[model samples]
Target: MKVVIFETDAPLPIARAKHGSYGDMFKALLQRAPSFATAGPVEYIQLHIHADKPDGDVRDFPPLEDVDAIIITGSRSNAYDTHIPWINQLTDYVKHALAEESKTRVVGICFGHQIIGRALDLQVGPNPAGWELSLTEMALTSEGETHLTTAAKEDNKLALMQFHRDIVFPPLPENVTTLAQTDVCAVQGMHRPRKLWSVQGHPEFDTEIERELLEYAAGTGMDRKIIDAAIAKLENQETRVERDRAAVADAMAAFLLE
Candidate 1:
């Protein structure tokens, strides 16, 4: 399997915060994909772009056609930031990926989801009231239950590790369809035609990272009581690391084989 990973500034060797480390998550994801280790030599590439290295320097990278699947991760930067240097290139990358004829699969997580939507003609902006942190419920829309279930291992809710400030609200592309939505956020999960998929939460984070995120969020401008409640609630939430890793690996494997 050929997988291309787009890293959004967080888990690089040099980082301001240690909570968003994804290198371990990527290894875990590969291990979770039952076919990954045993499959005919899996190829995984990491694409880095962050505040420290805004240039993104894709000059040494291989041609896009060599990739069979793409995974774009979230960043601390906002998708609507017109001043960000890499924003345009990132948007173009999404548009090009979606427009490819080789059935190239793309998976966007968090900032990746928002940027992909914007590239596909959707408007991405702040939540106005702010964003949801920690674990929250994403009540599946009827459509969500049908198609999104393909990624689920069993019949139950999929609670992901979420940390975002911007939300997506514009209409999806003609070829796209909604798979899930929460009371506060629509398009929590979406699929493009049949090969591409994206989710607004983080399925790559482990238990330690999740806890770190919750603690960090609690200290922000959030109300003391509300933050306390969220932290308390997080204590009872399901870790689902194993389940999520399996689901993501399954989805990626299926996309590649198809």
Candidate 2:
């Protein structure tokens, strides 16, 4: 299968040194799925939306009909920020892609999730509860239990890696069903039938990358207490990373192959 990744941001220098680019991280995460492992060969095309060409404009993206599936990567840029023309263009591109075809499945992670929410006219902005950093426990909704192939079937709750200050607030768009949620963020995962699927957490994140991120955040002079808490949470929940990665990858594979 052919997949196009819309990369909105590059990884921090510290993290990038260890894990490579965000596109590489996502490719590694998705390849962990058993289905993807045996699905013959898969081709991935990465489009960096954060960069502008010599013409001082973001490069035009390929049409939705040209690929089997699309995955939008997390970004530091806020979806609601109109100052960034590329962000607005990317949001419009997502809306246009979904509107043009129903067969192309799209998955959004973190900033990507908020972008899709904004594209659908849902309220996407900062969370009143503040940043949801490090590892977090998310409970599956009834729809999640019944419809989500990504969740652990035997367990109602799953631990996922999260790093976001923004959220996709209710009421969700028509036909959209929330799959999972946490106390801090009401919309952790959502599916809009055959068109789109999105999750607030970072399935592509691993312990090492998160550690680098924490260090990077510390260098930024963010609150030391927040960094320490994130470190503690990361250390405590490190074991669950592999399990969550496999579950999410399986779900993504299923969505793409469906």
Candidate 3:
């Protein structure tokens, strides 16, 4: 399978100790979904858009005829922003891929999820209470579990890495179904019958990557007490490697195959 990575945000240099940049996170995701492509066979491209300058032309990338799948990564900005130049184009592209006779399959994470919602006419914005950033347990609904059974062979419970202030509300699109949910968020994962899907949390994140993000958040003037508390809670913490990775890989593969 030929997979194309569409990075909506850029991570700071690792030399700066900013930790898992968008590229790094996606690379880890690909590691879990190894069946999707060979080593270095996955093509990665970037769209650099920030608060200051959020517009760019993506007309030069490979056409849909050459793509088997297109994965969109999370962004630091909201999907409702009017500043991001390529935001509308990205939305249109996703909608088109899922339209009749399109081969490009899409999977969105974090901000990517929000963008998918927006593209499909669902609303996405900040949660009334604010962001939820922690290692949390999410239970797969029957539909979620069924999908997992096709793609996953390990534990049913998933301990996910997450950090998002905004979430989708009022349920998903009419054609979409909720696969999983936590106490905090309802739309953990969604399936549009077939051809497109999305997950709210970061299944691609590992301990080292999460640590880097925490450190970066601290440096960015996020509450020291909050950061310290979160770190302490996550102390000596190591994610379960095999089961979680396999589940994610399986779920994604099954969704794509459908």
Candidate 4:
């Protein structure tokens, strides 16, 4: 399979040193696909959100015919930021790609999730309840179960890592389907038939990455109370839950390939 990954933000220095860029982390996540071992080989191309070009066909992204899927990586930057030129450029690209492309698939995470919402003309803004950090347990709608179960080994609630303050709200486009939700974010995940899939949490993130993120967020003025509570969840093994990361990856793989 061939994929292009768009890295939206630079990772914290420590995390980047250990995990490489956000695009690289996604490259690693591709292995979680159920067919990876038998799929022969995969091709991946990386692009930064900052690298967008104006020309359509020969712009930042490869032609849709050349790629099977496009995945947008998580970013520390807010998705609703209109002040940033690259942010607007990326959103416009997504808006056009979603409307014009039919053969290729798209997946978005966190800020990327919000990007899809913005592209679709949905409400994208900060959550009134504030930031969501650490592993968040989320529920899948019946439609979600039907779609995601095709790619999952077993069916159950999802527990994925989250580190975002922004949320994607209602008035979804005609093609969009609400897949999963949690207490803080109603749009935890969404699907658009064979074309697009997106989520507000990080399936590629682990506890260690969250640890690094918590500190980094604090340095940027995120409240310590929120970070401390999230930290406790990571430290308390008794209540700790393993994320259904592989299951999500499996679903994404099936979505991109099918």
Pairs that collide, model 1: 144-179
Per-residue error (Å), model 2, residue 80: 1.1
lDDT per residue as tens, model 2, 167-255: 99988866888989999899998886668888899988888777777788889898989989988987756567777777788777666
Tens digit of per-residue lDDT, candidate 1, span 1-258: 677777775653323254334644665565666666666776777777755665444334445588777777878778777666677777777777778575567788888888878877788898876767766657665655554353452554566667787888847767777766777787787776546777788777655566665566566765677666656656744545446545656654554555
- Candidate 4: what lDDT? 0.77
Positional deviation of 66 in candidate 3, in angstroms?
A: 2.8
- TM-score of decoy 3: 0.83
Over 1-258, each residue of candidate 3 has an lDDT whose tens digit, in order, gives 566677777654552254455656665655666565443455555444433346655455567778777777777778877566678777777778777698888888888788888877887788887667756667887778776552233456666677788887756767788877877788887777567778887776665556667789999999988777766655554645335656776677666656
Question: In model 3, what is the error at residue 29, expressed in angstroms?
Answer: 3.1
Report, for every candidate in turn, its global Cα lDDT versus the true structure.
0.67, 0.80, 0.69, 0.77
Please write out the lDDT profile of model 4 over residues 79-165, one tens digit for every residue. 887777677877887776687645677899998889889988888998999888888877888767765553332544777788888
Error of 4 at 53 (Å): 14
* Candidate of highest lDDT: 2
Best-to-worst TM-score order: 2, 4, 3, 1
C-alpha lDDT of residue 42 in model 1:
63
